[model samples]
Target: MRVQDTLKARQASIRKVVETAFKKENPPEASEIISSPHLEPLQIRDYFAGKRWWDITFQGLFDDYIGDSSACLTFMAPAGVEYYLPAYLLMAVEHYYDGGIITEDLAYRLKRSIMREDLYRMSLYSVEKKKAIVEVLVFLLKEYGDEEALEAMRAVAMHWGSDYIKAGGQELG
Candidate 1:
Protein backbone atom coordinates (compact mmCIF):
# COMPACT_ATOMS: atom_id res chain seq x y z
CA MET A 1 0.00 0.00 0.00
CA ARG A 2 1.05 3.59 -0.45
CA VAL A 3 2.82 5.10 2.54
CA GLN A 4 0.24 7.84 2.98
CA ASP A 5 -2.63 5.37 2.90
CA THR A 6 -0.97 3.14 5.46
CA LEU A 7 -0.21 6.14 7.67
CA LYS A 8 -3.82 7.29 7.53
CA ALA A 9 -5.01 3.88 8.66
CA ARG A 10 -2.54 3.88 11.54
CA GLN A 11 -3.67 7.37 12.58
CA ALA A 12 -7.27 6.19 12.73
CA SER A 13 -6.29 3.14 14.74
CA ILE A 14 -4.30 5.25 17.21
CA ARG A 15 -7.23 7.62 17.73
CA LYS A 16 -9.59 4.72 18.45
CA VAL A 17 -7.18 3.08 20.85
CA VAL A 18 -6.47 6.31 22.76
CA GLU A 19 -10.16 7.20 22.97
CA THR A 20 -11.00 3.80 24.37
CA ALA A 21 -8.20 4.00 26.89
CA PHE A 22 -9.34 7.37 28.15
CA LYS A 23 -12.97 6.36 28.57
CA LYS A 24 -14.44 8.28 31.51
CA GLU A 25 -16.71 5.49 32.70
CA ASN A 26 -13.84 3.04 33.14
CA PRO A 27 -10.47 4.31 32.11
CA PRO A 28 -7.83 1.67 31.49
CA GLU A 29 -4.66 1.61 33.54
CA ALA A 30 -1.72 3.51 32.12
CA SER A 31 0.21 0.31 31.71
CA GLU A 32 -2.74 -1.20 29.91
CA ILE A 33 -2.79 1.70 27.51
CA ILE A 34 0.95 1.59 26.93
CA SER A 35 1.05 -2.15 26.38
CA SER A 36 -2.28 -2.59 24.66
CA PRO A 37 -2.39 -5.44 22.18
CA HIS A 38 -4.15 -3.26 19.66
CA LEU A 39 -1.86 -0.28 20.06
CA GLU A 40 1.43 -2.16 20.22
CA PRO A 41 1.09 -3.61 16.74
CA LEU A 42 0.45 -0.15 15.34
CA GLN A 43 3.36 1.32 17.28
CA ILE A 44 5.68 -1.40 16.04
CA ARG A 45 4.43 -0.97 12.51
CA ASP A 46 4.99 2.78 12.62
CA TYR A 47 8.46 2.46 14.10
CA PHE A 48 9.49 0.07 11.37
CA ALA A 49 7.63 1.77 8.55
CA GLY A 50 9.48 5.14 8.71
CA LYS A 51 9.63 8.42 10.63
CA ARG A 52 6.78 10.02 8.73
CA TRP A 53 4.45 7.18 9.63
CA TRP A 54 5.60 7.21 13.23
CA ASP A 55 5.14 11.02 13.47
CA ILE A 56 1.53 10.64 12.36
CA THR A 57 1.02 7.99 15.01
CA PHE A 58 2.61 10.20 17.62
CA GLN A 59 0.52 13.19 16.57
CA GLY A 60 -2.67 11.23 17.19
CA LEU A 61 -1.83 11.20 20.89
CA PHE A 62 -2.37 14.96 21.14
CA ASP A 63 -6.15 15.10 21.11
CA ASP A 64 -8.27 17.73 22.86
CA TYR A 65 -7.74 16.07 26.22
CA ILE A 66 -3.99 16.09 25.91
CA GLY A 67 -3.86 19.58 24.44
CA ASP A 68 -5.79 20.98 27.37
CA SER A 69 -3.48 19.11 29.70
CA SER A 70 -0.23 20.26 28.11
CA ALA A 71 1.00 21.94 31.26
CA CYS A 72 0.73 18.68 33.18
CA LEU A 73 1.96 16.51 30.36
CA THR A 74 5.49 16.11 31.71
CA PHE A 75 4.22 15.46 35.20
CA MET A 76 2.04 12.70 33.81
CA ALA A 77 5.08 10.47 33.36
CA PRO A 78 4.44 8.65 36.62
CA ALA A 79 1.05 7.73 35.17
CA GLY A 80 2.75 5.80 32.30
CA VAL A 81 1.05 7.64 29.43
CA GLU A 82 3.68 10.35 29.29
CA TYR A 83 6.42 7.84 29.90
CA TYR A 84 5.70 5.66 26.87
CA LEU A 85 4.84 8.47 24.48
CA PRO A 86 8.40 9.69 24.08
CA ALA A 87 9.71 6.30 23.08
CA TYR A 88 7.72 6.45 19.85
CA LEU A 89 8.75 10.05 19.24
CA LEU A 90 12.37 9.21 19.85
CA MET A 91 12.07 6.34 17.40
CA ALA A 92 10.67 8.75 14.84
CA VAL A 93 13.63 11.09 15.33
CA GLU A 94 16.09 8.21 15.14
CA HIS A 95 14.59 6.93 11.93
CA TYR A 96 15.02 10.40 10.43
CA TYR A 97 18.76 9.73 10.38
CA ASP A 98 18.05 6.51 8.52
CA GLY A 99 16.60 8.33 5.49
CA GLY A 100 13.11 8.65 7.00
CA ILE A 101 11.06 11.80 6.73
CA ILE A 102 10.52 14.24 9.59
CA THR A 103 8.10 17.07 8.96
CA GLU A 104 9.31 20.65 9.40
CA ASP A 105 6.88 21.28 12.24
CA LEU A 106 7.95 18.17 14.09
CA ALA A 107 11.58 19.08 13.64
CA TYR A 108 10.93 22.59 14.92
CA ARG A 109 9.06 21.29 17.94
CA LEU A 110 11.95 18.97 18.72
CA LYS A 111 14.44 21.79 18.39
CA ARG A 112 12.50 23.82 20.93
CA SER A 113 11.80 20.89 23.26
CA ILE A 114 15.43 19.90 23.58
CA MET A 115 16.15 23.31 25.00
CA ARG A 116 13.75 23.00 27.90
CA GLU A 117 15.28 22.54 31.35
CA ASP A 118 12.49 20.20 32.46
CA LEU A 119 13.05 17.86 29.55
CA TYR A 120 16.77 17.81 30.19
CA ARG A 121 16.22 17.08 33.85
CA MET A 122 13.74 14.33 33.07
CA SER A 123 16.30 12.53 30.96
CA LEU A 124 18.72 12.45 33.88
CA TYR A 125 16.38 10.29 35.95
CA SER A 126 15.99 7.30 33.61
CA VAL A 127 18.60 5.49 31.57
CA GLU A 128 16.14 4.67 28.79
CA LYS A 129 14.91 8.22 28.59
CA LYS A 130 18.41 9.61 28.69
CA LYS A 131 19.57 7.29 25.93
CA ALA A 132 16.60 8.05 23.73
CA ILE A 133 17.09 11.78 24.20
CA VAL A 134 20.74 11.45 23.29
CA GLU A 135 19.97 9.42 20.21
CA VAL A 136 17.39 11.91 19.01
CA LEU A 137 19.66 14.87 19.72
CA VAL A 138 22.49 13.22 17.89
CA PHE A 139 20.25 12.59 14.93
CA LEU A 140 18.90 16.11 15.06
CA LEU A 141 22.42 17.49 15.14
CA LYS A 142 23.04 15.96 11.78
CA GLU A 143 19.70 16.94 10.34
CA TYR A 144 17.96 20.02 11.76
CA GLY A 145 20.06 21.39 14.61
CA ASP A 146 21.52 24.84 14.24
CA GLU A 147 24.54 26.10 16.17
CA GLU A 148 22.57 26.80 19.33
CA ALA A 149 20.64 23.53 19.33
CA LEU A 150 23.81 21.61 18.63
CA GLU A 151 25.52 23.27 21.56
CA ALA A 152 22.63 22.58 23.90
CA MET A 153 22.36 18.96 22.86
CA ARG A 154 26.07 18.46 23.26
CA ALA A 155 25.93 19.81 26.80
CA VAL A 156 22.98 17.54 27.55
CA ALA A 157 24.81 14.50 26.19
CA MET A 158 27.88 15.21 28.27
CA HIS A 159 26.00 15.81 31.50
CA TRP A 160 23.59 12.91 31.09
CA GLY A 161 26.40 10.57 30.02
CA SER A 162 28.47 11.40 33.07
CA ASP A 163 25.55 10.94 35.41
CA TYR A 164 24.55 7.66 33.81
CA ILE A 165 28.10 6.40 33.96
CA LYS A 166 28.32 7.35 37.61
CA ALA A 167 25.15 5.38 38.16
CA GLY A 168 26.82 2.35 36.53
CA GLY A 169 25.04 2.58 33.22
CA GLN A 170 26.84 1.03 30.27
CA GLU A 171 28.00 3.10 27.33
CA LEU A 172 25.59 3.28 24.43
CA GLY A 173 28.32 2.02 22.12
Candidate 2:
Protein backbone atom coordinates (compact mmCIF):
# COMPACT_ATOMS: atom_id res chain seq x y z
CA MET A 1 0.00 0.00 0.00
CA ARG A 2 0.93 3.65 -0.35
CA VAL A 3 2.69 5.53 2.47
CA GLN A 4 -0.33 7.71 3.15
CA ASP A 5 -2.50 4.64 3.33
CA THR A 6 -0.10 3.12 5.81
CA LEU A 7 -0.13 6.29 7.87
CA LYS A 8 -3.90 6.48 7.85
CA ALA A 9 -4.17 2.85 8.76
CA ARG A 10 -1.72 3.31 11.58
CA GLN A 11 -3.54 6.41 12.73
CA ALA A 12 -6.86 4.61 12.76
CA SER A 13 -5.34 1.80 14.71
CA ILE A 14 -3.80 4.31 17.09
CA ARG A 15 -7.13 6.03 17.55
CA LYS A 16 -8.78 2.75 18.39
CA VAL A 17 -6.01 1.68 20.70
CA VAL A 18 -5.93 5.00 22.47
CA GLU A 19 -9.68 5.07 22.86
CA THR A 20 -9.82 1.54 24.17
CA ALA A 21 -7.00 2.14 26.60
CA PHE A 22 -8.71 5.31 27.74
CA LYS A 23 -11.92 3.45 28.42
CA LYS A 24 -10.13 0.68 30.26
CA GLU A 25 -8.17 3.05 32.46
CA ASN A 26 -10.97 5.48 33.21
CA PRO A 27 -14.08 3.56 32.31
CA PRO A 28 -16.57 6.11 31.02
CA GLU A 29 -19.41 6.88 33.42
CA ALA A 30 -22.98 6.43 32.23
CA SER A 31 -23.10 10.11 31.39
CA GLU A 32 -19.77 11.50 30.26
CA ILE A 33 -17.88 12.98 27.35
CA ILE A 34 -14.19 12.73 26.52
CA SER A 35 -12.10 14.89 24.27
CA SER A 36 -9.37 13.43 22.15
CA PRO A 37 -5.91 14.29 23.37
CA HIS A 38 -3.97 15.57 20.39
CA LEU A 39 -2.08 12.84 18.54
CA GLU A 40 -0.24 15.23 16.25
CA PRO A 41 3.11 14.05 17.57
CA LEU A 42 2.59 10.61 16.13
CA GLN A 43 1.85 12.30 12.83
CA ILE A 44 5.16 14.06 12.43
CA ARG A 45 7.79 12.04 10.58
CA ASP A 46 10.56 14.24 11.93
CA TYR A 47 10.85 16.48 14.99
CA PHE A 48 7.49 18.11 14.46
CA ALA A 49 5.64 15.04 15.59
CA GLY A 50 7.57 14.88 18.85
CA LYS A 51 6.90 18.54 19.51
CA ARG A 52 3.22 18.30 18.72
CA TRP A 53 2.62 15.21 20.81
CA TRP A 54 4.29 16.69 23.88
CA ASP A 55 2.43 19.94 23.47
CA ILE A 56 -0.99 18.38 23.11
CA THR A 57 -0.63 15.83 25.87
CA PHE A 58 0.67 18.29 28.45
CA GLN A 59 -1.33 21.32 27.45
CA GLY A 60 -4.48 19.37 26.91
CA LEU A 61 -4.24 17.87 30.34
CA PHE A 62 -3.44 21.19 31.92
CA ASP A 63 -6.01 23.22 30.06
CA ASP A 64 -9.11 21.07 29.93
CA TYR A 65 -9.06 20.06 33.54
CA ILE A 66 -6.83 22.19 35.74
CA GLY A 67 -8.74 25.42 36.25
CA ASP A 68 -11.98 25.78 34.34
CA SER A 69 -13.83 22.52 34.33
CA SER A 70 -15.81 20.78 36.99
CA ALA A 71 -14.49 17.82 38.96
CA CYS A 72 -16.35 15.53 36.61
CA LEU A 73 -14.42 16.62 33.51
CA THR A 74 -11.18 16.66 35.44
CA PHE A 75 -11.63 13.13 36.68
CA MET A 76 -13.12 12.17 33.35
CA ALA A 77 -10.07 13.08 31.29
CA PRO A 78 -7.86 10.23 30.11
CA ALA A 79 -4.89 10.78 32.37
CA GLY A 80 -2.25 8.42 31.01
CA VAL A 81 -3.30 8.65 27.40
CA GLU A 82 -0.11 10.34 26.35
CA TYR A 83 2.31 7.60 27.33
CA TYR A 84 1.98 5.04 24.56
CA LEU A 85 2.19 7.37 21.57
CA PRO A 86 5.76 8.41 22.35
CA ALA A 87 6.97 4.84 22.28
CA TYR A 88 5.23 4.28 18.98
CA LEU A 89 6.92 7.34 17.53
CA LEU A 90 10.27 6.29 18.95
CA MET A 91 9.94 2.86 17.42
CA ALA A 92 9.20 4.47 14.07
CA VAL A 93 12.33 6.60 14.41
CA GLU A 94 14.34 3.54 15.35
CA HIS A 95 13.22 1.87 12.16
CA TYR A 96 14.18 4.94 10.17
CA TYR A 97 17.58 5.12 11.87
CA ASP A 98 18.32 1.45 11.32
CA GLY A 99 17.48 1.95 7.66
CA GLY A 100 19.42 5.26 7.35
CA ILE A 101 16.54 7.58 6.34
CA ILE A 102 18.31 10.59 7.82
CA THR A 103 21.47 12.84 7.68
CA GLU A 104 23.55 15.34 9.75
CA ASP A 105 22.24 18.65 8.37
CA LEU A 106 18.77 17.24 8.79
CA ALA A 107 19.70 16.25 12.30
CA TYR A 108 20.49 19.86 13.21
CA ARG A 109 17.16 21.07 11.91
CA LEU A 110 15.41 18.26 13.70
CA LYS A 111 17.03 18.91 17.10
CA ARG A 112 15.58 22.38 17.51
CA SER A 113 12.10 20.93 17.51
CA ILE A 114 12.98 17.66 19.23
CA MET A 115 14.25 19.72 22.15
CA ARG A 116 10.91 21.51 21.87
CA GLU A 117 10.54 25.22 21.19
CA ASP A 118 7.36 27.36 21.10
CA LEU A 119 5.80 24.33 22.72
CA TYR A 120 6.23 22.41 25.94
CA ARG A 121 9.74 21.52 27.06
CA MET A 122 10.81 17.97 26.18
CA SER A 123 10.24 16.22 29.51
CA LEU A 124 8.20 13.55 31.14
CA TYR A 125 8.85 14.48 34.78
CA SER A 126 11.40 11.70 35.51
CA VAL A 127 14.53 9.94 34.27
CA GLU A 128 12.41 7.48 32.36
CA LYS A 129 10.69 10.45 30.80
CA LYS A 130 13.95 12.20 29.93
CA LYS A 131 15.31 8.94 28.56
CA ALA A 132 12.27 8.50 26.34
CA ILE A 133 12.69 12.09 25.13
CA VAL A 134 16.40 11.52 24.46
CA GLU A 135 15.88 8.19 22.77
CA VAL A 136 13.94 9.90 20.00
CA LEU A 137 16.57 12.63 19.77
CA VAL A 138 19.47 10.16 19.55
CA PHE A 139 17.67 7.91 17.12
CA LEU A 140 17.21 10.83 14.75
CA LEU A 141 20.77 12.04 15.18
CA LYS A 142 22.22 8.62 14.46
CA GLU A 143 20.38 8.52 11.19
CA TYR A 144 20.84 12.13 9.96
CA GLY A 145 23.50 14.00 11.97
CA ASP A 146 25.78 16.07 9.72
CA GLU A 147 29.48 16.33 10.56
CA GLU A 148 29.14 19.22 13.00
CA ALA A 149 26.14 17.75 14.78
CA LEU A 150 27.61 14.30 14.29
CA GLU A 151 30.80 15.57 15.95
CA ALA A 152 28.68 16.75 18.83
CA MET A 153 26.87 13.47 18.84
CA ARG A 154 30.22 11.72 18.63
CA ALA A 155 31.35 13.54 21.75
CA VAL A 156 28.27 12.27 23.49
CA ALA A 157 28.81 8.83 22.05
CA MET A 158 32.38 8.87 23.32
CA HIS A 159 31.14 9.73 26.76
CA TRP A 160 28.39 7.15 26.57
CA GLY A 161 30.27 4.67 24.43
CA SER A 162 31.09 2.42 27.32
CA ASP A 163 27.46 2.36 28.32
CA TYR A 164 26.45 1.70 24.76
CA ILE A 165 29.01 -1.07 24.48
CA LYS A 166 27.78 -2.57 27.72
CA ALA A 167 24.31 -2.56 26.23
CA GLY A 168 25.63 -4.72 23.36
CA GLY A 169 25.57 -1.89 20.84
CA GLN A 170 28.58 -0.98 18.67
CA GLU A 171 30.89 1.85 19.73
CA LEU A 172 31.83 4.54 17.27
CA GLY A 173 35.57 4.66 16.60
Cα TM-score per model: 0.37, 0.28
Q: What is the Cα-based lDDT of residue 155 in candidate 2?
A: 36
* Candidate 2 error regions (>4 Å): 1-85, 97-118, 144-173
The lDDT values for all models are: 0.39, 0.34
Give one digit per residue, the lDDT tens place, for model 2 in 9-127: 64455444333432223222322222334333222212221233323332243344233211121222222223333423333343333322222133343333234423322232334
State in Å the error of residue 19, model 1. 23
Task: Supply candidate 2's per-residue lDDT for 31.
Answer: 23
Q: Residue 115 error for model 1, in Å?
A: 8.2
* Structure candidate 1, residue pairs in collision: none
Q: List ranges where model 1 is wrong by over 4 Å.
A: 1-56, 62-82, 85-88, 91-124, 146-151, 155-158, 161-173
Q: Evaluated with TM-score, which candidate comes out highest?
A: 1
Error of 2 at 150 (Å): 6.6
Candidate 1 lDDT at 152 equals: 41
